[model samples]
Target: MTKEILYQKFGYVLDDSLINEIINVGVFKSFSKDDIIIDINQPMLYIPLLLKGHIKILREDNEGNELLIYFLEAGETCTMSLTCCMGKSKSKIRAVAEQDSDLIMIPVQKMKEWFHGNESWRNFIIESYQIRFDEMLDAIDSIAFLKMDERLYKYLVNKSMLNESATLLIKHQEIAEDLHTSRVVISRLLKQLENEKKITLGRNKIEVISN
Candidate 1:
């Protein structure tokens, strides 16, 4: 694949030389929706810079239930993966393609190569850590303070935003899995949301009410 997408997606934040370094060393990869890009205990070999679509970051429990950490959109990289890469440790979370997507996978070594020489590269990494840190804090707050119904609503709204559509092509069981709950609870909550004029449900789909 041509590296033009990298220039287009990252041209604003990354300096030309830094972007070219990425182009020279980065491997372009694509993932279909729902593909497992990274799994718990997997070694982090490449740092992924999303070029298209969204990726969902998730944490799995000892029993395999999952809680969504956040979503990575185009122009974003997963900071958790960076941590794992830098430490030479296995991944602690899972990443799944939220939609058909493209990414540039830069080898782990280049992180140190460009960090000091390229101001833009350094800032990008630092800022990504800051951004993801805030998101993690928000995730913690949600778990600590929000009711299940409110959390479900927020999750639906987030999906709608990520897909850039009012309608989400999804299943209740999928939502339950991400929320680390049973499907029956998700179905009941979704119906309650619909009755409250928050959303409308259909077979394997959800339409979030905007007004």
Candidate 2:
């Protein structure tokens, strides 16, 4: 529950003074699996620092098509949300807990002050932006270049990796929503993958066979 342990997860060794300052202003929060932590078009209330578990960052098109942009695990932050907060604007991205997660939230004003007061904090902010930007680019490439089936395959692999399990306990409809496709298309591709001996599908679970 302490920010000290949270910062340590990120390989940051904050001295007692700085740690105390952060603890004074930040609030710790825990989320259940699939919880919507931040909604699109909402005001940015707190800058979240992921302490444990994974969070999926999503972007929705004007027509309501949703895409998974990236995942933030322990030791990371959401760059898109940070940018929106600094600009004093509404959020354009949505963040959801991919699993049970714990995080610390630092208010907007304190976040700004920390950049000037703490050197490590400033470096983390810069690194977070660069890392998230590269991930956004990868998401764009997947949507633009990869075929639907290919994308679905990669998505399954990624999901398995994220969940740390080869057997994915998820529904076809949920996968379709994240990939911005229809359940029928996902079902077709999944069947094809099964026929090809790449994966084995069960009632609501997918087990990877080859890759």
Candidate 3:
């Protein structure tokens, strides 16, 4: 996509000169479905701007179990940028393309330069970090204050916004990991919801039946 188009898509206004600078240092890359875009514990290099498709951020626990953290849609930048900015060598998060995806890789130094030179870009990054920070706080609050059923309900509501039909094609284990609960608890909660006509489960899909 053209620089103007990308800026428009991301809701950022950039001058022609700044756009040219970004284009000079950015490289476009495509990944197939299920491809690993960023591996866990790898050296920080370039920050990715997702132009198309979906990516999932994940990590493995001490028991070697993979946990799902969050999903990134189109027009979102990778969390690696924020982590790297905080002087982290390796990221605990791994990024994988859930579908065939196109991304722009911006060198860290180039981004730093733009961030320093452009007030708008710097504000954008700061706002993005603040939003992520708030989300982390909310997640912690959910874990501490909400019951398993309530947590599952909230997740279903959030996923329903992304998939309007109330059906979510996500794995049960992934839900367990994201909620920091056991798979058995998730299964029981899902079954209870189904019994109450609150939700229905199909192969790899959960449909919320109640509002």
Question: Highest TM-score among the candidates is held by which one?
Answer: 1
lDDT of 2: 0.87
Model 2 shows how many backbone clashes?
Answer: 0
Query: Model 3 residue 19 lDDT?
Result: 61
Task: List the candidates ranked by lDDT, beginning with the highest.
Answer: 1, 2, 3
**Predicted candidate 1 versus true structure: per-residue lDDT over 42-104, tens digit per residue:** 988898999999999999888878999999999999999999998999999999999899998
Q: What digit string (tens of lDDT, one per residue) describes model 2 on residues 1-211?
A: 4655755775463445666777788888999999999999999988998888999998899898888888998888898989998999999999999889998888989888888888878888898999999988888899999999889998998888887888998899989989989999999999999999989999999998754
What does candidate 1 score on TM? 0.97
Over 1-211, each residue of candidate 3 has an lDDT whose tens digit, in order, gives: 6565467646564566766776788888999988999887777778887777788777688876675566777767765455764584776777888779888888877777888898766776777677667766776787689987988988788767644558788888868876667889999999988888888889879988755
Mark the 10 consecutive residues where model 1 has the least summed lDDT: 1-10
Q: Which stretches of candidate 2 lie over 4 Å from their true place?
A: 1-4, 13-16
State the lDDT at 109 in candidate 3: 77
Clashing pairs in 2: none
Please give the CA lDDT of all the candidate structures. Answer: 0.91, 0.87, 0.75
Give per-model TM-scores. Answer: 0.97, 0.92, 0.84
Which candidate has the top score in lDDT?
1
Ranking by TM-score: 1, 2, 3
